[model samples]
Target: MLRPGSTTAPSTPLIAPLAAPRTARPRRPGLKAAALAGLLALPLLLPATSRAQETTAADASQPTAPAADAGGGETRTEVAEAKTAEARAAIAAAQEEDANDPLEGMNRAIFWFNEGVDTVLLRPAAKVYRTVVPDFAQTGIRNVLWNLRSPLTLANKLLQGDWDGASVATERFLINSTIGLGGLIDVAGDHGLTYEYESFDQTLAVWGVPEGFYLVLPFLGSSTLRDAVGFGVEAYGDPVSRYLSNTHDDWASYTRAGVYAVDLRAQYLDVLDDMKRNSVDYYATMRSLYRQRQNNYIRNGKVDPDQFPSIPDYDSK
Candidate 1:
């Protein structure tokens, strides 16, 4: 084969001129001259034929070279295009999934209701707490009082299963909350602590009240259908209810409701804010969170924030 840049071969074939007309006399001399001429011209002519042969041979050896390379390039291009299309489709699906959450409307309703209750009833009560109490010191005392009351209720609840322990704990809670605080208000006793804690809530559980279906009550926070009613009844039995009636004695109903609203608001502020931010379905979010809390309570008899997702916050830290 010829090298890529070379235009000519080394041997060039020569052409012979026509021999002098064959004559009868002295034809040998003429033949010899013709042979000599043919020999001399053969070099130039041979080179041309050799080059043509080399070109033909090279062409014959690689008939499919260009076609094979072209086909491979096309295949590579098609694969790249397909991969790009697939990636775009995946991104579109993800965006669509994010856009279509089902619980948005319910969540909005709950959010607005909670906001209204907070503004109208709860904030004012907190202000009263601020005014009556001595700075940071009173809040700590109030917290302790609140905590002492919780154990009594918790013991009362546990006692339905282990009645004896409930009886003992109730006595402890009553003695501590009422006498310990010096007759101002036996808050724990108002909830129905006899010598021990006793209440309709504990009574119902003792009588085997099945926990009804869980329901989200927007401003009121989490409760089962049955427990919600239980809460209402229990609220009337509160020590503060008696205090408001006997001491303040004027618009006692309104004052008691305001206090209840304040306490409720303070308890749920962090978790409620979280649901507003993280959940697309506000009702479902609340339901799920409440259920989760209940399950933990059943298991360990306490609320642990670790089990729940963090509520949304401005800083989100």
Candidate 2:
């Protein structure tokens, strides 16, 4: 090489350059490979999750101090507040369950027994009745039954010192009984004269009697002590019931009551099924519904925004 490159200043004698560094290219994993990798990585995440939970619990137990960054502090505060509110709501719900039903055991037993009876007899009978009776006839029967309650509604209205309500009841009864063919038709209601359902229980509530506790009666699903007493009073004072007891057989009123029960159960079968399906706690759900309905009734179906849930067209609907 020196003889060939005499003018090239003698090529550096067999000088070998250093080897360049080599980098291995990373290979992209396929779908199965990636899934397997994720599976392998899953166990590592468990500890992280456990740590997060522990941190959350610790944060919940200890009062939080504001962070140095204003935005971070506000975010932390909001999260802490949300957690606290959730915990408080859970505690309140537990307390309410306890306070709502003092006789929970007895009520539960009665509820089970009632359910059995409905399954065995009432439900079957209602199904048959619904299939046998025409819609128009059933409507007529309901209207007649409603017409019969006019007297009791009137009594409650008078006791509540609602003279105008009493007058409306009287006028509606007279018009329906005479012109509506014994109230097998709703002639009065069709003429824009609406009748509201009032009860002596509502009157008692107006007079400052607290609803003692939720009660589930045999054959009657949901009630309170106040409502049960009012129901008894209404039953005894009902004009049709009294007439049947006085003029007809003593058992006739009871027969009439049974008929009424079957009718109501039939009408509400779908509604009750829906409630039970959607409810997390059927008994509690029914109690709440009954209370809501009672409150609405007491206020002439008005939703008092402060005391009750807002439901448009509640009373009328």
Candidate 3:
């Protein structure tokens, strides 16, 4: 017979035992020794068996290594896809910006020149004005300036076929110029005739003139080709400009222009500073903001609410 747990084959029996006469023989001493040895090893074998069973249970309780690897790979793939999508969106936005700004090289050069002027001259003057001028006085000055531009606004409104806007502008101008002490106070605004600023550029936009390549003017800042031409037209046609030209009072025109620039810059001191501090590319940021602001103006504040703060719409009373 083969021994238990042994790999060796049993030897063939030379002769068969007789079935009729079976001899009763004593157990061998070797058999007794083997049985004793088996008893002695039983405790060690039991512990080993128990440890093997525990190992099998632990392996069964956990996820397979291949499955864990697959799950990790899926998560990484999702993250990669998300990053790719974001990159694509950024690329598309950059392309659109490039399309709008075909004159980017020249525009950027002018933009830097304007920035230098603003930083050295305009910004300091604006800071001083903001510091020295009282809030009420600043408001009055702004109102006066806006009121002075009312005629231009009216003309542009009429040109754009906005009769109601034209009427409102006329009423506001007449009411403020007289009762409001030359528009020092917003009397018409209190009476529900809120001011709405209109410009020749805006009229041109309403008239279906496309805004040609973005521009950064010498000292006036952001504009488009159409707007720049419209500005020239407005300047030539302006009553104040024409009167000043006729009277040969160039000094008065220069003074008025200076004050207007200072007041406009003063109003946006904190806003521009914050934008510059937070922006990665200040030029690109300004370009985007300028376009958005122009669009908002053209739409008469009917733009997406999410795109505010690029430029303040003081005319939206």
Candidate 4:
């Protein structure tokens, strides 16, 4: 299972204004080449993954059948194959839509560059942060922040007429913030309140958006246009952004960026393969998924269960 620190919060509690402008992190001379090399080498590590896939295909080709049903089974297999082909075609059509959109291509480039910067620099720092800080404390800090912001999410849901979602958001926020301690100002079990958290992605679904447009962003991955915009808007409203702007401390900004990157990386890792597997056109898949999620969030303040794409069956599995 993916660890909690990842997606522990809906959005980065730290806002964009608290950090430097969204530009590529400048790399040292020759570092770019090294980053490129690392990117290229990533696929090389998947030889065993590929071999396993081959074995699975071979096994699948030699299907087992009950002795009495051989002829009928052949027909069934053909029908199944046809359905699989149709599914593949549908996925491809979705991908084509994403590819045709000019914005997605640009997003993809940005996503990779961001990934390179994070993998090389930010991720290492995050590992250290985790080591130096108590895990429980950090997670607690994150949850506290999320609680404080839940009201804003609640209001948005209410405006959208998603009363059920607004109620749930309000309840979770109140329970977590009060018990989580005024979110730092109230503690949970101590106050005798308990609630489960929802994901940022899920929140988008409640808002009503499209899904299946796949985008590989430089720092972000596999996002739709709606999600990208939502991230930006959320950043604008974050308290951390307000705090950092008032303080004007460069170090504070950097610290916030580091934490934000770590949180984002962890969340994306969970659904990375699902995005790739569900659509032949990575761009369209992201767009579709993101759009669907946003529409869901707007209309009901929650993603419909069926809208979440399943992770493709991994041959290695």
Q: TM-score for every candidate vs. truth?
A: 0.43, 0.69, 0.72, 0.48
RMSD of each: 14.7, 17.6, 13.7, 37.3
Query: Which residue pairs of candidate 2 clash?
Result: none
Q: What are the per-residue Cα lDDT tens digits for candidate 2 across 101-192?
A: 88989998898888899889998888887889999998888888888889998988899989999998998899999999998888999987
Q: Find the candidate with the highest lDDT and give its number.
A: 3
Ranking by TM-score: 3, 2, 4, 1
TM-score of 2: 0.69
Across 239-277, the per-residue lDDT of candidate 1 in tens digits comes to 655566678675856744555456555655566667778
Local distance difference test, each candidate: 0.59, 0.81, 0.87, 0.60
Candidate 4, superposed: residue stretches over 4 Å from native: 1-91, 94-105, 163-179, 182-218, 243-254, 263-317
Question: What lDDT tens digits, residue by residue, belong to model 3 across residues 266-316?
Answer: 999999999999999899899888888788888898956534322222231
Cα shift from native, residue 222, model 1 (Å) = 3.1
lDDT of 1: 0.59
Backbone clash count, each prediction separately: 22, 0, 0, 59
Span of 10 residues, lowest total lDDT, candidate 2: 308-317
Off by over 4 Å in 3: 1-83, 90-95, 304-317
